[model samples]
Target: MAVLQVLTTSVAVALLWVVVESIRRLFFHPISHIPGPRLAALTWWYEFYYDVVLPGKYIFKIQELHLEYGPILRITPDEIHINDVGFLDTVYTGLRDKYEYPLRALRVPGGVGATADAKLHKLRREALVPFFSKRNVLSLQHLVTEKVNQLSEIVASHAKEESQINLSDLFFAFSNEVRGEISGIMKVQSSGTDGKSDRNPTEKEAVYESVLLNESLPPQERTLTRLEQEGALLALAGTESPSLSLSIIFYHLLANPSILDRLRTQLETVPVDASWTQLEKLPYLMAVIEEGNRLSFGVTARIGRRAYEELIFTPSSYANTPGTGTPNTEKSYKIPARTPLSISTLSAHTAESVFPDPFTFDPERWLGESGRERKRFQMAFTKGSRKCLGIELSNAELCLVIAALVRSFEMTLYETDARDVSFEHDYQIAMPKMGSQGVRATVKFRV
Candidate 1:
């Protein structure tokens, strides 16, 4: 009986502690003044419910909450989400640390992309920046051309056989194999795929010469295991975003025949064998790519940054969107230093104020004088010192591959619709609906 009484008292004390702590988080936390759902402020389970249980819906849910609460919202117990694009530079500027929550989730802590500290990230990134420079990346056009030919041949074979092809899967495969093999990128991307370490000493050294030979990195930072994590990070970046963008681009092209014809007419302005520079010069082609990047949204996840100092944020026109039906009130709020904050690509791309009818595949929005100014709003590749390093290479691939496929073949959608390529779920990269076989098409060699 005495033992039972002791156990009962312990349980009661624990429950009391929980209740008190909940109250403190709800009303007395440092960011208690920030307006958001009380349940979110009180616990992380609110975010986990959306991110895990519902599976990647927290990003969308956070936008909805922003409408009800205003521009600045406490998304989790410790994280803040700002829905205003005007605040993007402020949130992403300077040397800011990444929030470790999402970084840890990526499971590549040693990689530059996954490194959380701003200073450390700079160290790791700077060591390899020269290898990814535009001059160096453009020199890989020869490799890109080879891959494009291989991709074209695969599609051509399908066309000759009158077989239906899943372009989504095709592009995914093309991206993995073609784009992954560029430069010494092959070293980083293909490192552990076969689970063998039989590579020659020269091959092993060449794979990691940049980070491996850098005099700056500590001995601990250059471990084979850590470099493998870097490899994994590079593999994911090279594969996922390009394939997702390509699928979306071609799906939109096939779906809109007028757009396709317009693009084709533009392509005719240059030879079928036009170079990347010539293809990239065509205004319409550039616009289509811009639209593709907008829709693909690169990484749809909210990988927010931690501010180095306190920030004053005032709601802009982009905040409290029309669907929210909230009263327009532009008020400034002070965000504490070291707070985790983000303006996700979804919020930035689909902001009604910025891109009207944002969901539609309208390439015209990226045309003329307005289009040039609009480029500032493109955050599919996040800005700042930690921006994606593969932008130049990705753009080159998109231009070259899209030009070759469109000019070489006619692809009609087969047993596929927008849902196959739509941003239905956020798998860190945009994912379509469940059971999507991807954008399938019946192809014919264009004569």
Candidate 2:
């Protein structure tokens, strides 16, 4: 009798799943119009399974789908994946003032990362903007330079000792140090020694990493993954991080050494004392960093107005796009109220219309007159009042780190084949698998 009861319950659950899927298919014919794997049409489980279980392979899946189905595809009943910048423009900033999507939680025991309130998101963005403001970033130039110089010395010492310097480790340390300074946290020693400086608690590190490192905890234990996911949902009603973008920058630099050389030369022109005011002069470094962000968009999704009360137009907006008109007029979608919309930044970044040869790491694409045209389509940092508050700071950090390293050391891949420099990325905020052929580079002292 007990065995029969268990079987009956299992069968009932399976039947319910089929019914739910069938109902979803009936109402979601719009999703059916877009092409994807058959499994995706019948249910979202196929995509979710791969997303959660095989994140490393999932990156290519979207790209493959684009090759097969043009620019737009559907991931679930409500989610649409667009590889066309024009459509993204219409959706992300066009017809909708806001949309809805799953929020991310990167840590547990606390729900600081998840919340869907737009007002709260605005408050948070406003609060954090000062840290990444042009003035603040300029003020931190000395600190950035100091850290970069210190890093160079450490790398040089390792090179002299015939020790292989793990670029991945160094980059993390570098970013951590920079993050610490920006956030007013304690210094992070990269040499992994010197007990003099007190470091912030390990938890104060990238709050976004909570998901990547905290997947195993039971529900009762309040895992980092749960915390981060929940926190993201509440805070921004979305999710994103800088890990993948950083790793990809290094990967591409190694793959295309010429590009790195060009960037180094460009950085050479910027005087160490030059303020952020002179940022406009360093086009090449800016281009490289932009291309890096395009290729490895940190925050892959966002939610904004699903429908709007009015309409407005402003194609020149990059970040901070709320200026287009009434808070929701920038879009055309005439979104009905309370609609849930999700925009995929990866798709937008790779849109052929927005970026010619979207797959190539061409900094020139961003350096020419056509660069203005590209700007009209660029949304990696996103646009609107909700644009990434860290944009300016992140750019400065990238410039400082790249320029400093190139000036002090000759960076080369430790692996014989540049392709070997690759790592498996598990995509919840641009993270690479912790240990797969990570960034091992030999930094020779240039002096």
Candidate 3:
């Protein structure tokens, strides 16, 4: 009876502590004044419900919260989410001392994407920057063009048969082949059956020729495992993002005929074998690419950054301010050190004030000087020091593949609709709705 009584007392004490902690978090914590659901403030289960239970819906939920509360909200007990587009530069730029939040759920140990230490990221990224530089990517244009031509031929063969093709699979395969060649995982002979010379040092070979050749670095940095990890990261990113963008672009283009007509008219002047530089000059094509990037939700996950020092944020627009009145330029808030802050790329991309008619896949919105200025808010590739390393390479691939495909063939959706292309879940990377065949289409060779 004494033992039973003791056990009952312990359980009662534990429940009391839980209640006290919940009350403190809800009403007395440092961020308690910030507007958010009481459950979110009290526990992490609130975020887990959206991120894990509902998959990628948290990004949209966050936007909803911002709409209800303000531009800023306490997303979790220890983290704050900012929905203001004006503050993107402040959060992502290199001018401020910022560190990536210590990766918890997505940590990959030694992988480049999982590297939370800013200094380490710099050192590792420096070795890769040269390989992915604009000059280097431009030089490798022929390699990308080769892959694009191959894809064009494959599509042409399908067009002859009037067979429906899964563009997602084709794009992913094309991206994989290009990435393999670049990383030296797959070697392409200098001369193919078509009598074209395709020679470029693989990323693996480049690293060996550049950094690995140096004997002064630590032994661990020279291991095959390290190089493989880097290559895996490149290959994974290289495959997924471009494929997603291509699928989404094709879905929108086929679904809208007038838009496709305009695009086709613009491409008529260019040769089927146009170079990346040539294709990039077409204003309409560039706009389409930008729009595609914006709509694809490139990285749907929230990117967290840690504050090493206190930072003050001042609202620049009424959308960023609390309530319905005009923004007060002088009103600001200081984020204390060690606090984790994040800005959703989806939220910024879909901001009604920023992108007006945010849900529409209208490429026209990206056309003129006004469009160019508005693109400053586009965060698909993100911004600042930690921006995607393969931006130039990815852009090159996108332009080359998109131009080649559009110029050489006419594509129409094969019994597919908007739902197939719509974002279904946030699996770290955005995924199309479940059971989607991924933008299947019928192709016809263009004269």
Q: By lDDT, who's the top model here?
A: 1
Instruction: Give all candidates' CA lDDT scores.
Output: 0.83, 0.54, 0.74
Better of 1 and 3 by lDDT: 1
lDDT of 3 at 115: 69
Pairs of colliding residues, candidate 1: none
lDDT of 2 by residue, 248-269 (tens): 6777887788888777777677
Candidates 1 and 3 compared: the better one by TM-score is: 1
- What does the lDDT read for residue 85 in candidate 3? 79
Worst 10 residues of 3 by lDDT: 186-195
lDDT of 1 by residue, 254-280 (tens): 999999999999999898889888888
Greater lDDT among 1 and 2 belongs to 1
Most TM-score-accurate candidate: 1
lDDT against true structure, model 3: 0.74
Off by over 4 Å in 3: 1-13, 95-102, 177-211, 214-217, 318-331
TM-score per model over all chains: 0.91, 0.69, 0.87
Error of 1 at 277 (Å): 1.9
User: Cα RMSD to native, each candidate?
Assistant: 4.3, 9.6, 4.8
By summed lDDT, the worst window of 10 consecutive residues in model 2 runs over 320-329
